[model samples]
Target: MPAATRERAIEAAVELLGAQGVRALSHARVDARAGLPPGSSSNWFRTRRALLGGIVDWIAEKERADFDPAAMPVITHLDELIEGLCAMVELQSGPYAARTRARYALFVELAGDAELGEPLRRQRREFERWTERIVTAVGITDPVPATRAVMALADGLLLHRLTVDPDLEVRPTIERAIRALARS
Candidate 1:
């Protein structure tokens, strides 16, 4: 499928899924949300599972772009990482915020389902790779604990933002964690 069409389908699906849960994201609904024809979603996405798989990939790609580790300054990688994380939390107010929240929700909900497990596994693996890269860049000799710390912090912050409140600040918390990690 063409990149544009696939991206549109995934975007629409995410929005619809976010607003109404995964059960409401029918092919026709996705097409309507995406402003495409009735069969466009079905033509582009064969099934809801396929559309969700595309969403997983799309979320990974967008997160990677938004948190571009290479774009950070070489010296203050910790600060840069913190800034990237803060920016992500702040993205809760952006145009795609609903999609972001829905994607995570779907990820957790479908994690145990056999049909979506593979895609979730791939998504998590990709996230781990990114986490490992940040750890390595910060010169953390033992990446095992460092990666775990990053994941834990990220997950906590994400949950806090999504569940507790949107205005919740995570920068200080993330910075404190980074400081502790540095001292370790």
Candidate 2:
């Protein structure tokens, strides 16, 4: 029941994130959306930042958990990788898009805060691990630089999408970037 309440809070937060971004996320809003009494979120999560962190952890864990090495299809060509990423983008809409946008926003907000810096660094390292595997599977050696580039492109694309068109399909841009990376 406690877990259910926590998840409800996350769901509410994700919805608000999608509609209004992180600027509008608050315990009162989540409580109202989740149908819980005001201050219930405080019982589960102490601070607003803690709630944001929990939401980030929840989203990241779900995405990472779905990542199965054995299920990954073998890719020998760059187009295959592009196809794979497009599929991912297609599958990862709704709450995931909001979650992604919230993460990028939170990163900017917490970048200079010494308290949250280490956790953000750890999350970045985990993302690097996942990106490195993808870059390697794309048949690239020296995936570190390529991984960084892809990450930067992905971030840029997300920012663009969030700020411009929430309904934007970024797969084509990613496909073009993949071709460019292959040429380099």
Candidate 3:
């Protein structure tokens, strides 16, 4: 299959996973959602596992595009960290919101599926490592715990925005949390 076709299918899969759920993801569904002829997705992904794995890969790709480390400023101070994190939250809450929703939905779906757990965990570890780098750059004494705390705060903030308050002003909240974490 063409790479563009494969990418389209993956994008469609993510959209389906977000708009519907795991049950909504299938070869036929992806093909239809992607506007490809029937069997196109199956040609690219032979099994449901392959399809789901493709979705994970696509999510990583989209996230990398959304959050490029090279494009970010060196976060040497708490204020910079706050600014960077607030920007990230804005991205997650705005343009990439559906993808975030899809990611969490996939996480819940993969919890019981042993076959899909490793990829999800690997993706999470990559995010944690990225967070660790930021924390370490900000002169945190214990980068690991700081990274975890920041990641937890980000997750909670995103979940809150998704569930309870879509219009929540996240920058102030994230700034205060980062200040507290920096002092700790």
In terms of TM-score, the best-performing candidate is: 3
Model 3 per-residue lDDT tens digits across residues 21-120 = 8888889888899999999999989999888888877887778766767866777888888888888887887778878888998889888877776667
Q: Would you list the clashing residue pairs of candidate 2?
A: none
What is the C-alpha local distance difference test score of each model? Answer: 0.74, 0.74, 0.84
Please identify model 3 stretches exceeding 4 Å from their true place. Answer: 112-115
Residue 130 displacement in candidate 2 (angstroms):
2.8
What lDDT would candidate 1 get against the real structure? 0.74
Candidate 2, residues 1-184, lDDT tens digits: the string is 4888988888788777656777898999999988998998877888987887777676666666664445667666788778876666545444467766666666776787666555656766876777688788777767888889887876676666667776788877988888887777
Which 10 consecutive residues of model 1 have the lowest summed lDDT?
Answer: 67-76
TM-score for candidate 2, residues paired by index: 0.80
Better of 2 and 3 by TM-score: 3
TM-score of every model versus the real structure: 0.78, 0.80, 0.90
TM-score of 1: 0.78
Candidate 1, superposed: residue stretches over 4 Å from native: 1-6, 71-77, 92-96, 113-115, 139-141
Task: Give per-candidate clash totals.
Answer: 0, 0, 0
